[model samples]
Target: MRSRHVSVWIDAPPDVVYAFAADPHELSRWAAGLAEGSLRPSADGWVADSPMGQVTVQFSPPNTFGVLDHVVRLPSGEEVDNPMRVVAAAPGAAQSEVVFTVRQRPGISDEDFDADIAAVTADLQTLRGILEGQ
Candidate 1:
C-alpha cells in the first residue's frame, strides 16, 4: 500500500493539540473530511456521515505518546486505518505538528490517491486554524 503524510504545524503545545484532536467530539470542528456535525456517540465508537456514506469511527485509547490512530468502517463493510499523531516540532518546543497518514488501497487510481491526499491536507489546515485561533 502507498501512503502519504499530510501535516500541519499548530502554534500550540503538543498536549493541547492532542487533547483536542483526540476527542471525537471535536471532530466536527476540524475534521471536515471525516465528519461534520453528524457525529454521535455509538455503542462501540462514533458514527458519522462521510462522502461515501455512513461510517463508524473508532479511535485509539488516549495515551502520552500522542498517537491518534483510528479505524473507519465504511458502509460497504471495509475498514480503513487512519494513522495520526501530534508531536512537538522540536524538543521542549511549544508548537506541535499534526500528521495524518493517508493510504492508497490496491485498486485505487492515481487521481483518487491524489484527491485523498488533498482532502487530508485541507482537514489538517482546518485543524491548525482552529487550534491556533487563526
Candidate 2:
C-alpha cells in the first residue's frame, strides 16, 4: 500500500478542532464532495451515495489522544482505513494541526492517487475554513 498524508493548520485549539472532526453530523459541512453525493446514515454506519453505489463510513470512538481514525467500506467490500489526528502547536498555543493519512490500495493508479490526495486536501481546507470562521 502507498501511504500519503495531508494536513492543515487551524487557529482553534486542538480540543475544539478534534471535537468538530469527531462528529459524523459535521461531515457533510466540510466534506463537500461526499455531501453533494448524498451521503447519509445507514443501519450500521454512515453511507456515501457515491457513483459506484453506497459506501459505508465507520469511525473510531472519540478519544483524548486526538485519534480520529475511520474506515470507508466500499461497494466491493474493501475497507480503507483513514487515519486522522489533531495536535496542538504548543503546550498553550491556540493553533492546532489536523492531519489526514490515506493509504492507496495496490490496484490504484498514480493518477487516481493524485486525485484522492487533492480531494483530501480540499476537504481539509474546507474544515479549516469552517473552524477559522473565514
Candidate 3:
C-alpha cells in the first residue's frame, strides 16, 4: 500500500490542465503507459491496452476542484485507484501543478515500483509539453 506522488509543473492554467487531463479522448496523447493509442469508449468506461494488459478506466465526474481521480480495472479483475489532481502553482497563478499518486501493490518489487514512478513522471512531462505547446 506504499505510494509516491509524481508531479510536474505546466505553464497553463489549472482549469485548462484539468479539462485536458480529465478527458478520456486525450489520454492517449500523454498517458502512454496507460492508454497509448488503444483507448476507446465502452459501456462501462474507457478501455485501453495498457502495459499490464487491457484495462477499463473510469474517471471521476467533472468538477471545478481539479480532481482527476480514476479507477483502472486490470484484465485480472483487480481495480487500481489512481489519484490525480491539477492545481494552481500559486494563488491565482496561471501555471498548474499536476500530481499523480503511484501506489506499490502488495507483491511489487522495489525496482518495479521505481519504474512505475518513472513512467508516471514521464507521462506528466508529456502532458506538460503538450499543454505548454513545447
Report lDDT (Cα) of residue 79, candidate 1: 89
Query: What digit string (tens of lDDT, one per residue) describes model 1 on residues 60-118?
Result: 99999999999999898888999999989888899998988999988899999999999
lDDT tens readout by residue for model 2, 1-134: 78888999999999999999888888878976444554577887888766446789998987998898998888899888889999999987899999999678899999988888988899999999999999
Of 2 and 3, which scores higher on lDDT? 3
Among these predictions, the greatest lDDT belongs to 3
Evaluate all candidate structures by whole-model CA lDDT and list the values in order.
Answer: 0.90, 0.86, 0.92
| Candidate that beats the other on TM-score, 2 or 3, i.e. the better one | 3
TM-scores, in order shown? 0.95, 0.91, 0.96
For model 3, residues 90-129, the per-residue Cα lDDT tens digits are 8789999999999999888999999999999999999999
- For model 2, the local distance difference test gives 0.86
| Superposition TM-score, candidate 1 onto the true structure | 0.95
As for model 1, its CA RMSD to the true structure in angstroms is 1.0
- For model 1, the stretches where C-alpha displacement exceeds 4 angstroms are none
